[model samples]
Target chain A: MGLNLEFMLSIIPELLSAMVITLQISILAVLLGIMGGLVVGSFRVIGPKWLKMLIQLLVDYIRGTPQIVHILIIYFALPRIGIILNAYWTGVVALTIIATGYEVEIVRTAIESIDKGQIEAGLAIGLLKRQILIFVLLPQAIRRIIPPLTNELTNIVKASAFLSVIAVNELTKISNKIIYETFYFFEVLILTALIYTVIITLLGMLSNFIEKRMFSTNSEANS
Target chain B: MDISFMIEIVPRLLRATWVTLQVSAISLMIGLVFGIVLGVLRVYGNRFIVWCTKGFVIVARGTPAAIQIYAAFFLLPRLGIRLPLFAVGVVALTFNTSGYQVEIVRAALESIDKGQIEAGLAIGLTRWKTMLYITLPQAVKRMMGPMTNEFANLIKASSALMLISLYELTKSGHAIIAATFKYAEVLVLVALFYFVLVQSLCKLSAYLENNVFNFGKTADPRNEFLN
Candidate 1:
């Protein structure tokens, strides 16, 4: 059968409402990811050799495997270890873990991107290491991190769709349910895909704008 | 928790890993061909052609791979073009891979020095000839690192196929868990399989970077470990 535009239009409200859950889970993950990433990523750079190595192994394990497996581990396997989480919490934990892994890398690189000369200047001015880190390094690093951090938001949004596998009732899950009932596969899916495209494309544009502004201001400050 | 159950599923898990690798490899190979064409068109085609390629990339990238897989699984039957689930997964995965690969290829192509193309033209090589003989060879080298990243991404993204019950690595884990309810044991093995597979690809790419593509240029530090 042909696409039913009327049927597709009818489901928009339901799908849009479910979009809230998608955003909620993604935002939670991104928030947790930033905080966790900042803490762990800093340790990765400046902590003891053992901490660095430990973080290395964590990053390798998380990055090397698929997120689906992580979901299974957190949602399914963790119960065996006596830690239980519902599907929503499981989705959040899984996405946060994924986000934090990348965020850790981003933070580490952002911190590294700060010019050593800047640190030396802080020292030349008699600033303590802590002061240099807090006053000089982090300020610059935060500016550098924002663009990639914004990019990561889009990644988290896309990753949230995986929650559908666990019946998380997010936008994709809602759409899948509708498709099953209506048999309007093309219409429902195309609309769902459109919603995702709009969300991601907007986030991507914002990232580009921020990158341009950050770099331009950076050059101006340097000059 | 069941050590014996985990041991029992090793053979089946290994077979599923084979499926995972096969799907990823086949999709990536096909994707490379389409990506090259789209990347070329994006770089050199008329406005209409460029717009089409850009639109394809946007939709392919913007939507989730799971949605794409579902669309393939569900919509293909309506067109009277039904395929097995395995083929459907590959179709969807290839479509997804080409979108990302197009960007890699485009970036590689654009990074080629303009002067070289001009020199080729000055020596009477057509624009197409220059692209074929000079630009492509150099671009191919530059694309290798990013392409390696894309393949790793494809392998991970292919896990979305588990949603379609394609009996890939992750799906196999789900199957075993269903049969035995030993989620912990089955999934650890599945994750371990994917971990080793992706790590080996990363290591292989590193070796290629060091030995073959060694221009003495360092790789991007940000992507060094993250990808």
Candidate 2:
């Protein structure tokens, strides 16, 4: 039989509402990722040499693996150690861990992109390291980090769908439930895929808008 | 956390890693071919072809790999086309990986100087000859590093096949945990297995990228880890 568009249309509202959970997870994970990444990433940049090596190992180990393993490990494995998390935290923890690794890369790269001469000039003018970082380095890095950071936001939203495996009732999980009932399988999947496409495309557009507004005159920021 | 459990699990995990590599390798090969065709279509095809290729890339990339895998594993059988689990895993990955690969090749192709192809044609080279002799060689050279990075990415992304109960590396870990009740320890070994696999691949690419493709260039930011 052809795709039952009637079933598909009926499920659209439920799927859209479930997207709120998906967005929630994305927001939470993105915020934690930024905060944690800034901490780990800044330490890597400015911390001692031994600390840099340790953090680098941590970053690589986390970044080297897949997010799905992290989810299974956190949700399933952690309970063996007496730390049981319900469905939601497991996804957030895994996503934040993954996103944090990426953010570390983004921050490390952004910070490095700033000219050493600028920092040296700040030092030459008798500013402290902290003051120079606040005044000179950070302003440059934040702008540079925006494009990649938003790129990570879309990643969080996308990867958050994996939470469905743990019964997190996010967008994908909710849609899967409906598909189980209706067997309007292709139609449901297409609708779900379309929702994700719209969300990601909007994020892309937002990044473009910000890029245009922030980098209208500066040529280097075009990237 | 038992030492014997970890020891016993290693072989099965290694075999599962082979399965993971199999999927990634086949998909990477298929993706490389389709990705090139898609990239070429963006640059040289008619308007409808360009739109169709771009639409594929956008949809493939925008959604999560897990959802795509689920849709394929669950939705396709209803249309009277039942694929083997291995085939399903490979199809999902090949489709997903090709989208990203298309972007990489397209960027490299577009970056070629306009004058080079014109120069080739000016010297009596056919359009096809220009692509073969001039355009593709340079684009392929520049694409080596990114393509290597994407290959490692394919291996990592293959872990998502666990969602559909495909018995890859990650799913192998889950089986170990289920049988042994050593969740943290088994999963640790599983993570280590993946880490070693990914690192070795990265090092291999970095080695080739470092020695052969220097082209007198210093470290690009993306290539810094290679050196």
Candidate 3:
């Protein structure tokens, strides 16, 4: 079938509106995931043995199972348990949980990469363990964590497409709806992909720019 | 929380695990073969091939596998190309994994020292021979960890096959829970099965890394602890 520009154009506004929902879900999920990661990562490092083991098991389970499976479980199973969440919230919670697993690893690695001498120096200079972690270690670790965290954020945005399966009217879901309505599958799908490409590319460029700025400042400080 | 219901479902879930493994294993094998070729083209081919490879990787990596599976299952039939859900799942995942694997293999290839290639050439080995003998062996060694990790990722990603009704592990869990209505218990069990499988793979990869791929002897102790 030939492409239909007119049909595609008519749906652009609708798709754009849907893209806003996609953006909201992506951003909120990333924010919540980052907060969860901070707690999980910190616990992995310093929590009691049982707590650390529990957190590690949580991370493993999240990492091992697919996000799509988690989405299915949360979307389908939660309702039966009397915790009825809408599709969008279910999508957000599922994505956030998976993202937190990955982010915890990233955060933990970034923290561990900080030289041991710095932590020892802070401790020797009268800082408590918590004080050193908050003041000296995390500041340095956060700088290192930014790049991977941004990559994870971009990944979370792409992963939001899975929400379409559960009937979230995100960009991909709207495109599916348009395709069903107009039967112009290729044209509409291509347009949706182009829009996603542009957003993800811009996100990648912004992260690279931030990385450059941070590294330059880091080098200046070292010098 | 009815333990007996879960106990009864164990046999069914075990049968489903076989399907999940079949899907993951078949796709991983196919993807690795395709990925190596794509990686070679990516590293050595002309600009047009490079761009095409990059486009393949970007589209696959930048989108969810569910959409790709949907496109494969729903859109392909509309274009007069019909396939079973199992075939569609395998093809879609092969395409997906090859995208990521190309990058991994390309990096592995590039990580080999330039001087090694030169030494091979000095011995009168042809370009192809040098790549086959010297470059590929080193690349394979360096690639073991990443390849194993990707394999683990593919196993998890195969869960997306449920969208097309493939009756894999997750789908089987959904079926069991649908009947028994024990949502949390069933899902937690499903998650446990996945955890055990993936954690074992991770530990296996770590063992391979330490024993076989220990070319870089300056290993970090923390990594050992984490493993």
- Give me the candidate number with maximum DockQ: 1
The TM-score each candidate achieves on chain A is: 0.92, 0.91, 0.93
Interface RMSD of each: 3.4, 3.5, 3.0
lDDT of 3 at B224: 20
lDDT tens per residue, model 1, B1-227: 68887888899999998999899999999999999999999998899999999999999999989889999999899889979888999999999999999999999999999999999999999989999999999999988877887889999999999988999999988988888887777877888898898888887777677678995765544232210
Candidate 2 Cα outliers beyond 4 Å, as residue runs: A77-84, A217-223, B218-227
Q: Where in model 3 is the C-alpha error above 4 Å? A: A76-83, A220-223, B215-227
- Candidate 1 displacement at residue B195 in angstroms: 1.0
- Candidate 2, B31-108: lDDT as tens digits: 999989889888778899999999999998999897889887876687688899999999899989999999998999
User: TM-score order of candidates, best first?
Assistant: 1, 2, 3
- The candidate 1 chain B region of ten consecutive residues with least summed lDDT is B218-227
Tens-place lDDT per residue, model 1, A118-223, is 8778889998766777787778888888899988998889889989888899999999999889778899999999999999999999999999999987884332
Please give the lDDT score at residue A57 for candidate 3.
76
lDDT tens digits, residues A117-215, model 3? 777888789987677778987788888888888888888887888788789999988888887887777877778877787778778888999899988
Task: Tell me the tens digit of each residue's lDDT in model 2 across A1-223.
Answer: 6878787888889999999889888888888998888778777776767877888888878878877777777787567668777788877887888889889988888877777777778888998766776787777888888878888999889888878867898998998898788767788888999999999989988988877776786766444
- Candidate 3 iRMSD, 1 decimal: 3.0
For candidate 1, the per-residue lDDT at A187 reads 93
TM-score against native, each model: 0.95, 0.94, 0.92
DockQ of each: 0.63, 0.57, 0.51
